[model samples]
Target: MTKNAIEVNNLTKKFKDFTAVDNLYLTVKEGEIFGFLGPNGAGKSTTIRMLCTLAQPTSGSAKVAGYDLIKDSAKIRQNIGLVAEKMIMYDRLTAAENLRFFGKLYSIPKQRLEERINELFQLVDMQEWKNTQINKFSTGMKQRINVIRALLPEPKILFMDEPTLGLDPQTTFSIRDITRQINQDGVTVILTTHAMTEAEALSDRVAIIDHGKIAALDTPENLKNMISQGDANVFGTKISNLTSELVNKIKSMDVVTAVAQQDDYNLKISAQGENALNEIIDTIRDEGGNIASVTNSNESTLEDVFLAVTGKQMRDQATEKATPVHHRHGPAPKARVR
Candidate 1:
């Protein structure tokens, strides 16, 4: 059996004059949580839509759960479950009813469907709300039901697009835990999010996309380390009355590349390496510059990666200021997982 759950080769999608997804190629291994990270208009959703067979690609090919995206769309649908940002359950129906309805649509046997509904309610910690009308449910409750509805068929591959967008911290944590549990049960997960912290915490590997193309792809730690290397080290002391003469003296020390005043009293000196750090400290003590704190301020984050590649925050382009990028869609946009 193939070890890959998803494979895309030179996948491209265009909308009139706009190239939504440029020639993109990616592979997701079976049972891995592959994170799709990108800014707004970076083509994350466009790629997901093409992979899910909701929209046809302008060029190239893809396969999901061993089903060809072009020729076996139905089979792909049968093996995949999609949970979008917005809850998509019928308001009038009870939570249990909503799950049963989608379960039937997937042709799950009646006995299995009932067992699945009970299991999902317990899984999401919403067993108490199972018989309650969805219209009366809170936003978090409704979202939980939406997730349950998507899992009705026990799909082999699950696609979650901004599953925790706009949710409270508690609710978001709960959702993250649920996702981990689902993956532990052997379901291959594809997650798309612009939230750097979320991607860092959940993803096994991340693909950073920008301007409809992938700029970098690797583990979060490797990406951080790549940017952290070759950074200048700086040391600081109390914010008070150090003069230009004192600054000039500090700069003359071995390995001290440069020295500049930070504020009213604080001074910033850049050094070549760890050796420079000790030289600066001894020089400061001899020169009578009282040290306050020392720290490495040049470290890079996922945000730095986004700015380096896309020149903007993923959430900055989202229409709703409060909504994460994975949930935002333009008018008349075709619906996919999220």
Candidate 2:
């Protein structure tokens, strides 16, 4: 079996009476880009902080980059680069200066540090702006510099929290490409993001976290398949004025299982199969309901999986309260492991 690059067992953290993380377990393989997904208050940042050795886990044990999270935190820190969600760098310093500062902090030799800085500038496509002060940089540029600074030490593993949060589409694509390149260079990456599309695009595997625990963990394809399996053949029609009588009449059809109104005009009805669509239409027509447009709106996606599991969209769940809890033993909950 391949050895894991990072391992967490029963990891937990609490702040006062709130539990931020509860019995979280995870395993990231060497050279894999593991997407750690969750809403804003879902403890993603807290977990990354512990893994990066910036915050100790309140309970449980973890091993990162072959170093114990508690007993060998210093060693762990040396082996992993961290890019926090918030951009953190000196505004007065030039991008190149910031890289140099981080290189020195990591204790890179003077000669090697200069070479590494040059490489990082090229890696992040920031060589042209190397001499420009960070205060003059755009949000995307600052994010690129933040990542470069974290990578200065050539760590074996990287922890990135919302790395592309505020970036434009073009810049986000660039960052994603760079992340893939880094992983190709044999570095393991642990990333946290609320963007399902990004996770689906980049992760070798993804962990869906919610309520301070994992709701699902698997490859993106597998997670999406879970939602697909739950899908029923459904037909949606837009009517001028949907009413309770019309809804009940549609639900009473032989093939229709449920009927829901989208608004005053649109009605969505779930049916058993394709044949049911004709039956639904016949029934609606008999009732003198005129169909303006019909379409299938229940297509499965990563968003559907998230919604099915969390009962909310990733963006909406970000504002919920987050409580901290101590870690629990054993593997994390296996929702959709396949």
Tens-digit lDDT string for candidate 1 (1-338): 64999988888887766777788888999988988988777888878877776778878889899988877777788899999766788899898887877776777788998999999999999888889998998777788788778888899999999988888898888888999999999999999986778888888888988877888988888876654568446555563447666777876776755454557677655556767777777777777776667665655566555544554222545321111222122323332221
Clashing pairs in model 1? 239-265, 239-266, 240-265
> In model 1, where is the ten-residue run with the lowest total lDDT?
319-328
**lDDT digits (tens) for residues 232-284 of candidate 2:** 66566897656677777876676665554558888756566657878787877
Question: TM-score for all predictions?
Answer: 0.75, 0.77
Q: How far is candidate 2 from the true structure (C-alpha RMSD, Å)?
A: 8.8
* lDDT over C-alpha atoms for residue 173 of model 1: 89
Cα error of candidate 1 at position 271, Å: 14
Question: Where's the lowest-lDDT run of ten residues in candidate 2?
Answer: 329-338
- Which sections of candidate 2 miss by over 4 Å? 230-294, 297-299, 313-338
What lDDT is obtained when candidate 1 is compared to the true structure?
0.76
By TM-score, how accurate is candidate 1? Answer: 0.75
Every candidate's CA RMSD:
8.8, 8.8
| Highest lDDT model number | 2
